[model samples]
Target: MDVFEAIKSRRTTNGYFLDKPLSDEHIKILLQSASYAPSHFNSQPWRFVLIRDKARREHLGKIAGRSMREVMAKGNFWKRYLKYFRFSKEETDKSGDGIHIDNMPAVLKPFIKYLFSEKGGEMMNKLRVPYLLAIDSKKLVSRSPLILGVLLTKDEYKKDDLSGMYSLLALGMAIENIWLAATALGIGVQFISLPMEAGGAYWQECIDMVQPPENYELIALFRFGYIDPNAKRPTIDWSSTQRKPVSEFCYEETFGNKWIPKE
Candidate 1:
């Protein structure tokens, strides 16, 4: 696929990938592609730990499941992440970003709407959505042939510092490079967001298990493998999976000054 096509068509895999494992050559190519991304002052502070061991992957999946349960048990899951779910076209239009409800599984759609109501929280807990989701998540993680763990070297950016900001920007570029390359190769990628959702204290356990090289901290985890062409389409519609119009976000010269491209 063309580079632009890959970039424009790339989508996050929210469902399970096929049982295929990425070849060693494929992994090497992805890492090489990522290494080519530009970095601040050429610092290139990113480090990657690739997890392919089934036992270790299962361990990570367990950690992910535990972390997910801990978050849902707080009883404020909807309140904390409400803005990130768009259930209708109007809602998606207004936000211009966030996960569209259509992308969610069919079984979860009605429950998602219920989540906004005062009683929905109770319903969610009653239905054990969190537990069910965790089970599904474990199946995904355990079955994925590869999990790429991204790390950043210590003593660089503090996230609030200027250099740190640049380093992060570079890291994003690196991630995109890998993602696009993988997309071109017919692979799918999904984030392991449970660690962040569960917070540092819990994430430390994941770090210990993954055992990244010394002097590095885990930044992100992404599962990658081939997609199943025969998989059923997700129940929710996916119109918003496409990028928002440039006019919605791009500005002419200042904030709130919309930019209109000429034909």
Candidate 2:
């Protein structure tokens, strides 16, 4: 696929991937693409762990599931991230960003707003919503054919210096390259992020499992596999494809001057 086409096609795989595993060739290609990202002083500081063992994958899945349940069971998750939830197409169309929660069990329709309300925590737990979501997360992740752990060399990712920021930027670019390459290869990718979000012991467990060397720090985890065309939507799901127009984000040479296209 063309580079531009791959950028346009790349998406987060929110549903289940195909049962088939990724081939060695595809895995190598994904990492090779990341190698091309520009790093500060040519210090290509990224490392990737290709996790293919079934037992390891299942263990990670359990961690992810528990993390989800932990986060969702608490009020802070909803409090902190509620602004990003768009309940309807109209909401997403107007905002041109953020995930649109367009799929849910019919039972959740009437309680949608309530579920996000400050008073909903008790009711949410009563309904076992977190448990259901945890189950879904576990299945989506554990059954995945591969889990890729992204790490950055501590030498370049130093916390006390500007190199850390530079290294993170380079790492972001490298991940983008990998995502685009995966798109071109017909592979789907999604961040296994709840463990990080839940933080505390949950995040530590993930870090322990990924087991980055003392010289490297694990920064991200992603699941990769062939896209399943017939996968069913989860009990609840969100899709974010709408993007803000250039005029909304870009500026002219002078700040505050909105970018406008010439007719």
Candidate 3:
């Protein structure tokens, strides 16, 4: 498949065929594509956990649902405050003595809405697809820091202190590769960052199940299966949403100077 076509057509699958399963060969191909994604200094920090057990997937779905509900119930107070302040700033700043105080909600409202929506819970439940792929990484650096030499010793890389931004970028590229492969194979795939909240626990359990490096962190999770033909697909606005023109995004030697013609 053409790379650009695959990228343009790839969409997150919500309704998956419950009984359909991807063959081992196809899964292997998808993983191989992901493995070839670019990494910084050849320090491939990503790992994958494939969950195929139905009972385990169902348990995870329930746990995710409960977590969603708990987060929503507890988060409403702040959500309401932010919503009120965002739409009614004058009312938000009113005081008993007519002295308007700056009582604006400090947090971003869109993030809160995402946390409280049913789509959030649905996204969690959808992780129960036929193949649940989880990616992990070492929390600490290795004895030899490959080509980068960014680390002095294994102890130098702390999960909290060490920056994994490049590692994450690589992982994202890998995920995109998998998505494109799945699209070509007529398979459904969805990526979830939900497991991040339970990453510590998940990695602890994984460590018990598999011999992992002394220090590692769970990075991402994915669900794969067949698309449900009967499901109602959500409509997407392709026209209004667009990438900024090259002129708007690129600049010359200095910032804000157009690098290309505006029109």
lDDT of 1: 0.79
Each model's C-alpha lDDT? 0.79, 0.91, 0.46
| Clashing pairs in model 2, backbone N/Cα/C closer than 3 A | none
Q: In candidate 1, what residue range of length 10 has the lowest lDDT sum?
A: 233-242
RMSD of each: 2.5, 1.1, 13.2
Q: Of the pair 1 and 2, which is ahead by TM-score?
A: 2
lDDT tens digits, residue span 1-263, model 2: 99898998899999998999899999999999999999999899999998889999998999999999999999688778888878888999999988887888888888877887778898888888899899999998899999999999999899988999999999999999999999999899999989999988888887898788799998989999999889898888889999998899989998899998776
**All candidates in order of TM-score, best leading:** 2, 1, 3
Q: In candidate 3, where is summed lDDT lowest over 10 consecutive residues?
A: 140-149
Question: Where does model 2 exceed 4 Å of error?
Answer: none
In terms of lDDT, model 2 sits at: 0.91
Q: Which stretches of candidate 3 lie over 4 Å from their true place?
A: 76-163, 195-213, 233-248, 258-263
lDDT tens digits by residue: candidate 3, 32-84: 98888887776665666666665555544444334333433344422443433
**Clash count, one per candidate:** 2, 0, 1
Task: Please identify model 1 stretches exceeding 4 Å from their true place.
Answer: 103-111, 117-119, 232-240
